[model samples]
Target chain A: MKKILIVATIFFNINLLFAQSSIPSVDVKDINGNIFNTSQISNDGKPIIIDFWSTSCKPCIKELIAIDENYEDWKEETGVKVYAVSIDNTRSVNRVAPLVNGKGWEFEILLDVNSDFKRAMNVVNIPHRFLLDGNGKVVWQHTSYAEGDEEELYELVKKLAAGESLEEKH
Target chain B: MKKIILLFTILAFTFSSLQSQNADLGQIHGNFQMDAQLYNNDSLIGANVPSEKMGLNSYANFNYTRGKFNAGIRYEGYFPALNGFDAKNNGVGIPYKYASYTSEDLTVTVGNFYEQFGNGLVLRVYEDKALDYDYALEGVKLNYKPYKGVYIKAVYGKQRYYWNTGTGLVRGIDGEFAINDIIEKLADKKTKLTLGGSFVSKYQADKDPIYKLPENVGASAARINLYRGKFSLTGEYAYKINDPSGVNDKIYKPGEALIVNATYSQKGLGIYASAKRVDNMSFQSDRNADGKDLNINSLPDITKTHSYALLAMYPYAIQPNGEIGFQAEVIYKIKKKSLLGGKYGTTIDVNYSRVHNIQETQINDTIAIGESGSLGYNSNFFEFSKEVFFSDLNIEISRKFNKKVKATVVYQNLVFNNSVFNNGNYHKTIYSDVAIADITYKFTSRKALRTEMQWLRTNQDKGEWGMLMLEYSMPHWFFSVWDMYNYGNPEENKQVHYYYGAVGYINKANRIQIGYGRQREGVICAGGVCRYVPASNGLSVSITSSF
Candidate 1:
């Protein structure tokens, strides 16, 4: 009845949106305790990869370690930047800085204490990753990490860097 | 046929009108997840098939964002619910919906939202689906940034209790000020500070037959933070007025809590210390609700969350009535080419934590310690009780060997109090030791194999246990199998093995996994929150997608 029509109208509107989308704006903080917007996640026309993680997720640490081991080469070859965002709450948020420094990860770090950015991105799982093209359009996205998954991530970065289409637009 | 035609006509008309007005049609983003399980009767583990042969739980969310306005709706369904979840989640419905708009310095949200104020000491409205706990407030929330470095918010709503809202009305407001951000001169200084405070209260009609209960209860908290070069400190204290509730044995004692943490970090080295003391600090929106229902705030955990199967067997449940705990951790990395560190270097992590019951004495000679309708007890702010609740000490070492192999080893010793978690069934204290080893071998740039071995030795409770697992993964697929063996059970016939296997596929932002296993009864905890799950033999399948 009435509910059916309401759901239908919204469904149609969503289906009609086909253009490439850019990152949504949401408030987040840097490790230095500065509040900023997610739209500021930029690489100056270079490619960018954003990884959502938490302090207690074991798989996330493993993936980040692997990426760090190969980050220098990736930067030199593709000019791709990495931003690792921690979705820790107020209490655990303090651990993010120490953990990152202890692990010696050189990627840019952002803290999403209330998970505002995570909710905006519709990310339900940690280690959810997204690769944006030079235009800030999310050209590729992934969830979960297997042992060699970073290599596949690099493949998509290589294409996006070369101005190639990910063919992920739906 | 008529519905389809109307749907298309309305779609076409709205699409054309909206398309002609704005260049950006806005963006639609959402995520969906479904988990279903088919159960079987297994006598060995006390698992019995439910009347429903199968159980399914699913949730989907759709969010639309256009410029400064965004709206979303979440639909959750649990067909008779899974074995572990409460029976209340047996129907299907739209449990969450919201619309919000943001202006320069103000944002308004209506319908439903989640919020937290200053370490969540007094107020934190949130949802954690895995634990089947969601307290999403259904009402209005307003946020205002009146100044450069000041943020204030107010909320009024009733907590969602399963399919409906709770009987109580909840309201709260919070504000925070960043001194350095507000004062331009202090922006560039070496030190920084922030101050925050919150006040929250709940109201419900009192209709008790035997006792007179307070219809309105209020709680408040204040916090401060400090940051300097390579070091940071944070502390929060909360206090609540006298109130009687079902969870606290109906005692009319005021509540109080204190939490403090400090940390210092440098390259390849990190040190942390934290302490918390909670005494009758449980605050619930509903005066007579079940345990953990309609909770107004989240109590922070001062212990680490272990990922190992054996080490996490007996998890810590927050002692809402009264307890004190402390934790310390250090992480350091060894230089490459050093004697202890191989060619690729090594990382070592050490952590320790302990919890003790808070000392309590009689309020007077006329009343019992925890008698209903009486002042619970008198507790000194810094006194330690004679009984120990829990303790753990663990260390981990991770290293890389060549370009294809990486490994990690960990050892832990822990003590658990059975009386606390078992509802006073047995007050025996149990001690256990655990060891785990994980290794991975890369076959190519996109292929790898991993293995894990874990063992736990103990002289109490279930005695000893062992586990082994092996997994293989490619760029888009993974397969794994493992088994937990309780081989040292006191009764020979009770020794049993809980084995499980799973295979999964991942493509871009979509994943599907299927698993079959004999799950052992245990509690799963995250951030000090816990959920009890029963042992079962079942085939489980799950699918998750995000766009």
Candidate 2:
């Protein structure tokens, strides 16, 4: 009888939580020592790109560097922002700054010391990328770093940035 | 009535959420999965399980994350397990529960988790589904990165014993450094190197009134990996102190192992080879454990996992306590337009593997450690032992003809030891050859037909076998028929086993397959995940989907 009540309470809470859902909110610390609110990262309801990556992941680093090479052009054309979230925990955390500095990556970087943000985003494998619309709703997600994948990503980002409804793409 | 209502409510909720576009509850999306099976008695093939009437197994996992915080729960279920398995598991329970936080340079995980240190020679906690094996640890793990290219981890945990904890505690530390990244000035597109090392120890409170046993047993290993252009090399060596209990008995013995591998690949060609030597490295819980008996940590040998249907039937079981083995594999693709490449190009794969006992002393007397006397007599290292464990030589070729058709052919030769590898009362030696040919032809852009034929011949073990398969598929539907004819079995009369197969489909995310066949009981490992599926002569159905 006691166990039954406990299970019922838990289910009730889960159902309630599911009903009041909105854009996911996360707190992340940037590499430059600034706490950035993920829900408010992009201004004027612009589309945001979140790249979950780690230094040990070869494909992630390559993808980031490749994007960095063309980041300036992408921003000028689409007015978009890319948040490279470093999922490197304590075991690989110290390498985060050195890796970024060494690679000359100039994107906004945040540290989720406990993977608090990674879990909120449902990231199982890296490098996972999520595209958010102006209202901060996840519109698209893809896992793994592959060649030419970023090209397709940029096309979607541009479409969202143009205020074009991207819900049909999913 | 109440139970049915609750179940219906649950199903309705599940269905409704699956149909909704906003089903994801916040940033974390999680789901649970489980699979179970029951074994029925069959006099044929000697599977007359009397008391062991039914077998059940299940597992569920939950994942949640928000920002830098992540947590998960894994619940496992087992009831009256299969033969040779412990029956202590009879209910649903939490085998693994953990919460972890990752910062820029630091991560901490508290609770139960699986980990491996340096090829798992000293410490490894893992699960093999095919083997009905799950060894998880309840512990706390810490990872710290002090600098670029350097990482360190410290972990402490107690192994799980059914619903309880093992008597022993395991502690380990591992560190790795990538020199190429650390010394960026010397880094280029050409040269790279990574170095790692680990130390692990296990401790159990002494509880003996007569013989004294070491309270603590420890092992350490170091590894190096170098890569330049198309060449790569990796090697690790580990050593553990002598602590023989049940498995080794009154005989006191230490353990040591060496593993080395090298590979070079470029363009359309790839080649790899690996060799390992182990001596008295069988570390387990309850030293008295025998076949189908274990209470603690046991590391499975790292060896090539065969892929061919027959080549994999009797896979090699690493003899960590005493064994020497090597494997070599090569893959090549005939370049298109080349003289031998033909019009559509061809891909060929070749693999070979072998294992044997290591040199050992047959001394009957106990030798004290560090004594001036030689511990044991020296024996030949490369010579084959009286027992042949396992051997395999296989090759496969695949080709594409135009855009409508593709075909592949596979052939393999295998040698399986029945007495040691299988639970046969006598030496079951099987020398066999198998061949399979598969072809796929497309009639339209989204319609296709696939056909397969396989033949296997042998004079030992399960005897001769043959298989035929046909498949037809469209955009949202697929149908298949498969038959496995067991032309022979060493213990049973030669008879052909026929299996009919059929399947219904939705989209890629949902499909249901039903089949009736003489399913061979064996271990199946995919991407390092393993599970044991028992042999059954009944209907088999599978349904899977992900939204």
The candidates' DockQ values read 0.43, 0.06
- DockQ, candidate 2, comes to 0.06
Give per-residue CA lDDT, model 2, range B1-547, as digits (tens): 4675566567656745654754544333443323333344544533344254555555545666555676877667666554434567677778778888888778888987666554566666654444555566788988887898777889888777777767777788998787866888856746677888998888876676755777788878888877676676767788877766654443455677777767676656767777777776666544444422332333333344544455466666655546777777777777666777666566777778777767565554565322222333334545556666777788878776766777879888888776755546666677889899878787864577888888888977667888888878765567878877777766555464656666655432233455554556666643222455555554444443321
lDDT of 1 by residue, B1-547 (tens): 5676677667767786877776677888899999999999999998878899888999999999888899999999998788889989899999899999999899999998888888887888888888888988999999999999998999999999999999999999999898998999998899989899999999999999988888989999999888898898989999999878888899999999999989898888888899999999888899789886898888878878877788789888888888998989888888778899888789998989899999999989998888899988999999889888989899999999888999999999998899987678777998989999999999986788899999999998888999999999997899999999999999888799999999999988999999999999889987778898888899999999999
| Candidate 1 lDDT, A78-107, residue by residue in tens | 999999999887757777877887888889
lDDT (Cα) of model 1:
0.88
TM for every model, in the order presented, reads: 0.95, 0.72
What TM-score, to 2 decimals, does candidate 2 have? 0.72
lDDT of 1 at A39: 85
Q: What share of the true interface contacts does candidate 1 keep?
A: 0.53
Best by TM-score: 1
lDDT of 2 by residue, A1-170 (tens): 65565566556546544433233455455653233557666646777788998755655864785587578888888877888998754223433554464345678788764455765554545677777777766677666553345677788889988888655654
